[model samples]
Target chain A: MKTQKIIDLLDEFLGGERIKRTRREQAVLDLLDKLERKERKLLEKLAEPHDADEIRQLNLKLQVNRAHQEKARQALESWAKTGEAEKSDDGVAI
Target chain B: MPACWKSGHCLATAAAILAGAALVSAAAFDAAFARIAAGAAIFLFGMRFMEDGFAALTGGTLEHLLKRFTTGTLRSLLFGIVTTTLTQSSGLVSVVTISFLSAGLIDLAAGVGIVFGANIGTTTGAWLIAAFGLKVDIAAWAMPMLALGVILVMHPARGARGLGNILAGFGFLFLGISFMKDGFEAFHQAVDLSAVTAHGLSADLLFALLGVVATVVMQSSHATLLLLLAALASGQIGFEGALAVAVGANIGSTATAVIGSLGANIDGKRLAFAHLLFNTVTGGAVLAMLGPAERVVEALSAFIGIVDPTLKLALFHTLFNGLGVALLAPASSRIAALLIRLLPTPQAPGLTPRFLTPAAEAFPEALNQALRLELIRLYDNAVEIMAHGLHLHRRILFGAEPLESVVERNRDVVAIDLDSQYVERVESLSAAIVGAISRADAKPAEQAEILRTFQDACLDIVTAVKETKHLRPNLTLYVHHANADIRIPYNAMRLAVGNGLRAIDQLRKEPAEHRDTLELEALRVRFEQDDREMSGKIEAMIRDGRITPRMGMSLMNDLRYTRSIVRALAGIGRALFGEADATHGAAERVLGLSDDDISRLARGPS
Candidate 1:
């Protein structure tokens, strides 16, 4: 069978939800994954003793990753409940 | 001569000379002249098709081949010979050399070595024509080749089309040689060229000049050589005169390199000059020893069993070019150093456009490459200006020392006229880039997108420079302020911008294959975090009586400008370095966060 036909059959088997996730939602999930990994890494690094400056920058990066993680989680929840893409309020694509 | 040629009127001069020749030829000998002209046209067209076909077939392997193989003088020389022998066009090799040199892929020494090798490599065409084109009924082969070529030309595959074009090109080239041979034979029966042609060195000199004009007009030394070979085979020209014409053709071939380098940087110009120098010196040496050279060619031809005069002419071509390379190859490094000394990069008041040239603008892909190169130049200049404005040295900013230490050490204000610097360094180049973009031809949808991204990047760089200018005055004023609270935030702002610059610099330096857009996007998030922290610090300082209301207001405004500068730099970086690969670019666009996304994220679950 053709790849598209196979994908269609799979989608049908999965109740049409498998391939229907918006790219934005998937992207947000990817971003959340990266942020969470970064947060864990930062926590591990912070566990070791270091100078005050390195500690401060690491903490700042950790806080930023957590903040983005929180927003991505919220966006993911909204998408799940509404089945509609959550739009960025500013509409600026990086 | 190069200066006059680069003044942009050489094309007009060449065209006028060609027009005069055409008028005189037509007025003097009409039908035979038409045959020769048509033959030359077909030959040149064949070369064009072949060049285009090879370019398409090779895609980018030619560049990689040139880059990989052109390591030393001997290697570069061999690469030039092998590639030109395969392509049958020294001009194509020269243009590729210039393009790579302009892009800084290969150094000038390698470029000169390649040029030297190409001189000998181009001689193979003459040999091919003499051995096959003159000895046999080549037009018989041309007919079948053309039929097969047309069949393959209709194929949908690019490789098939490229192969088709190569076959068709050979067919046309063979046909053109046959036509020219027949035309010259008919003309020889009507009137003897030997009778009218001057004798001795004067005749040789005149024929050599004719060779130069023909090659320049046709823009193909192979065409000129094929015509000379046909004339020689038809008894329309003597062997010595034909040798002179070959010498002239070698010299005239440098015109292609000259034109190619017009769009290149100084190293490219140096390479073009080296090409001209090699050909001219060799031509001059050959002419000065024409009698001895002819005797040597004859002796070499007899030894090699080349009984035909056309074959002898081909031997003469190879011998002379080989002689040139043998004499010049050893000194390739010294010649490159000399060229560097002779043509130092001009110290213009402002950074000029290096890659935006009329030659580059002729093709969409070249124009896009040129624009990207020029935009990178603009980005570099803007970075320099912005670094100076922030009272920091670029070397220190882009160094290994911690950003906090770098900012702390570079506390003393550096005096600079930001407006003048902007105008001199950034504005002129920006204007040139915008003008080149506007003048660029309408492109395909994908290329049009690249141009748009380039345009946005240009704007981002200019805006970043302007923001640096706006933030400079207050930075220089209050960076060393008495109040620690005010000074610390300002220092923190410097550290932020510096860290962003350093990170982008590292990313830019990384190879394209290893580039990570996700990392850059994460850096964007990190920058947002820094900006928010600055905002919070300013608010707290104002409320806790650490800083006055006016100071806090100033702090807020400068914080905004700092954020703008940082964002602009990151945007420029992403536009230039982040989109290196299509897959990565698409993924970055899809997954990258926006300002609003970051803002909402900063609100902690809201």
Candidate 2:
């Protein structure tokens, strides 16, 4: 599943239709995939019954991932609005 | 022979005979005068023509040789010697040396070496005249040589014709000498000229002053020396007077360099001072040891078994200069340092207000080096501005409270009016670099690459700063996106910026040696790799639906902009390295990157 997701992202990145996306977007996509996997694992563990310690650990993990995702999402939004997320083939960003 | 020789008639006849002798001698005098004048003209013209032809043939090659081969003082000295010998003019060599110094081709020490060698090379002409003229009776062969020279002048080959003119000039010189000798002989006997026996300086001071005055008028020590030789040969001037004139000639020759450096830069003026100080000190030393030095010359002459005073004088010229160079070579650095101190620093910045001085502009290498330095400075300022913009970007992106100290400092530092002009200047400088790069055909591919990169970097920095300024209301979203981007692609961009700063700084510090081609290539590759990785991350984030469409688009554009800045930085590095080949690859890559990848990277994880 992760491989397929990565392949899809790579395909999308390489596609010529989008005027804005570039190689830098692929890096962000990879990071997002890792975050998603961590989040999915955390949710699966949360569905099971657990002792107080395990429940607390799960919550901590969930909170950390949520923070990471939120940070990533905000950064993405900034990139989107600024149209600066795509690494120009020229390799310069203001 | 006519019967006009008894009593008053005899006396009248004797007077007429004397007058006839004077008339015949006067005609000889005219002939000699004509030959000397013609010879001098041919000599001067030949010197110039030969120098120009040699300069044309070897000017570029010599400059390349100097630039490539001069590694130290010794090599520089040798280079000066070789060039002066080939050109046959110390004055020309000094001018070239000064130009090299002004262009910053050689450091102060090496320049001194070249100056030293040039002084020695100039004496060659004097030796040639003294040695060859004193040998065979050139007068007997002068007519034939002159005729041959004239015939050769009509040759089709310009160079051969020039050589012919030079030979003809030499013949005329000898012919002139022979006539002058006869004219003096006739004048002495026919008229008891009291003016020729006027009392003059037997004192050292007066003799030295005479030497100085003569040299100043002639503007050449060789001419002064030759005149002294002629006077001595005629028995009109004593040896002491001739020697005094020689000393004064040394002092007078320094005027050339001093006048040459009138409005020149600090280095040029310093070099002129070096010339003056060297001559003065050597003259003083020679004066102090005049008795001993003369004895040594006599002894050396005896040892060499040569007997002519003219030859002795020529040897003295060589010996004095040789001694001066030997004594002063070790102390050259100290002398140069003292000159620098005496001149003091100029109150104003910049060497000259004009961009390129006319003297400096003549040499292409010098002009190119100056242009390169200007570009490096411009690139450095651009990097600083970009760094400032990035700092502002970070502040606006994160809702983290602005540091109070920074805010207070900014309040004082950021005079809106002043900064606005500075900002505009920076923008204009970027545009100027672009324009210059576009116009340059010398290194076309390299220049184009540099221009494209510089433009991209300028745009990125401007956009980043402008967006950061506007991110006040959207601080929350901007901060979140920035944090995520910072971990991945932004991290690489930041590193690229750091590397770019280092490269630019290297150029600033040591432009001559720091234009490393390999390192720049490696940096370029790293930038490309980072951009590729960033693209992948951005795509996955969008595919996972972690970020909204609006957020994704924003992320894409911002990261693309960042990469563009990196590309531009890379371009600057390539230009600094003088590599034009990589520009096409950079351009192709820029065209190939897509916007979707940028959007995905900006969106982050689901």
Candidate 3:
């Protein structure tokens, strides 16, 4: 529903900060895949309230992951609105 | 003498002289000796100036090349060869390699690789002298070189000055060789080197020993090389004698490097040892194959259409060094590992000052160097104590663990016992510095004042550590207090003090020339500002029922103590560094706190 140019998408995500990756990282980045995966139970633990130090640590990591996810989503949304794609991790574009 | 002994030839000349000194005219001998001595001095000055010029002209291109090319052992070897060949000084190459290794710019294997190649590179100087100096009318070239050198020296640019020095060095090198050649040729006109040559192991040992002694006395191998080559060219000594002298010269060349490394770190010593080992092993291997090596040289010389024995000796010089590289360079890593075992760490695990030796107290410069080192030691101890007083681990403080997390981890431990650490690490060295300066032989007043200023810096460090002792009790109590009002201010103090310690530790590592004292000044200003803000915060807390009046009073006193501690540390900011330009105290303009800044902080609201 948004009308944006291809250049705007590239500027938002790829200006100044370049990943300069190859096709392998680009493929994973295009699909918005997490870099690594673990048991869903670790994610389940992160939803609980911070009651202990370990819980606090888990909360901190999830906060970092959440921030990363938000950034990635913003980059993808800009690309969807326009014809251009941000530099993917491996530098491939879909 | 090391050169003569190594060559197994110079002793015969000495004996022949002892036999014939009564026959020779005293004036003639004295004149010949004078020319040789003067030539050596000129040659040495030229060599030194040339090195200085090269260093200035290259800027840091040589360093860059060393960094870029020394990625692997083989690459480092080639880079070393090229750098040393261009520089014409193996000692210079060794110094560069050692410095690079110390800076963590290159790995040990790479440094060792360059060193092996440098040994081979030094032989090029011999080639220059033997192939050209012996054959040509050297004075013809020397005059023009000196003329060009003077012209370049007249230029205002630093690069031109450096080029001029290089030209002058070239001129002197040839001129000295010519003088030495004439002196040897003059001696040969009356006497023969043939009378001294014994064809056995004893002859070999004698020449090698002579070479070592001559190098030691002269404190230079290149000078000794010039003398040896001059003798060889004039047939004052035979090929066999030159070979032995070459071996000795290699061994004797290590002395200056070893002496230079006296106050340096284990890495520096290790590099020196590596140099010594390479030369000795190579020299030993050549001695082992001396007869066969000679025949090989003779065959090679015949093949190359060479008639001059001097050129033949130059070929041998190149061959033996190349042989050493061939044999040892492949095992450089093994040699480095062996060196590490040979010269293990001097101290086990704790902080110790290396520069506070008896010799340091013998001269103003040495005393100054020692004092600088002791102050650095004091700084390191202060950092350790200050960092731990904030309940932060030493490793984590300087590690990847975020400073916030490091500061936050002080839930249960107050690990700082300041008095004992001060006694153990600071007091003895501080006392030694004072003692050394007092005993230093008749130092000039300006240098004495500089030492006094460093002594004052040591006092500031001790006082700062003492303040940490007082701050520690409050620091632990207030950091995790139930009251947010008190805890937040206390935590801020911890961060400020911790950051101060980190900055000082960093500045200690940086050279005096490169320090941005303005950044430190800004930080000091911020610390002063923090005191004003902290006082306001404490008053606000008392009004807000966040802390009682009694608690506020205690907090205020502690805050004042915090101010005192920071001021004490900042007090030495200039004194520790201000002594560089001792005569005019010009270093005072750039280093540490000015008197006004120190007084302002001292008189600030507490």
Q: Which candidate leads the pack in DockQ?
A: 1
**What CAPRI class is candidate 3?**
incorrect
| Candidate 3's TM-score | 0.41
Candidate with better TM-score, 1 vs 2: 1
Error (Å) of candidate 3 at residue A90 is 65
What range of 10 consecutive residues in model 3 chain B has the weakest lDDT sum?
B1-10
Q: Write the per-residue lDDT of candidate 3 for residues B1-606, one digit (tens) a residue.
A: 122321223333443453354234334566566555555445444544444455344313333455569877788888878887775657656755554554334666777888888877777777877766732355577889889997998898765876787787677666754654454444443323334666677788778777776665544556567778888877778789888887888788777556434433466678778888888888888887788999999999999998888788878888998888888888888887888798864442334567978777776777787888788777777767777666676677676565556676643343233544666677677677667766766443445667677777787787777777777766655666657787777787777676666655566568875543323443455556667777778778889889889778877877766666666565556556533544323223222344455345434435
How do all models score by TM-score?
Answer: 0.44, 0.41, 0.41
Model 1 deviation from the true structure expressed as Cα RMSD, one decimal place: 23.2
Clash-forming residue pairs, model 1: none
Winner of 1 and 3 under TM-score:
1
Candidate 1 lDDT, B118-173, residue by residue in tens: 98888888888888893235568778878888888889876687678877866776
Error of 1 at B329 (Å): 1.8
Backbone clashes for every candidate come to 0, 88, 34
Candidate 2 CAPRI classification by DockQ:
incorrect
Candidate number achieving the greatest TM-score relative to the actual structure: 1
Q: Which stretches of candidate 1 lie over 4 Å from their true place?
A: A1-94, B1-64, B134-196, B351-606
Point out where model 2 deviates above 4 Å: A1-94, B1-60, B134-202, B349-606
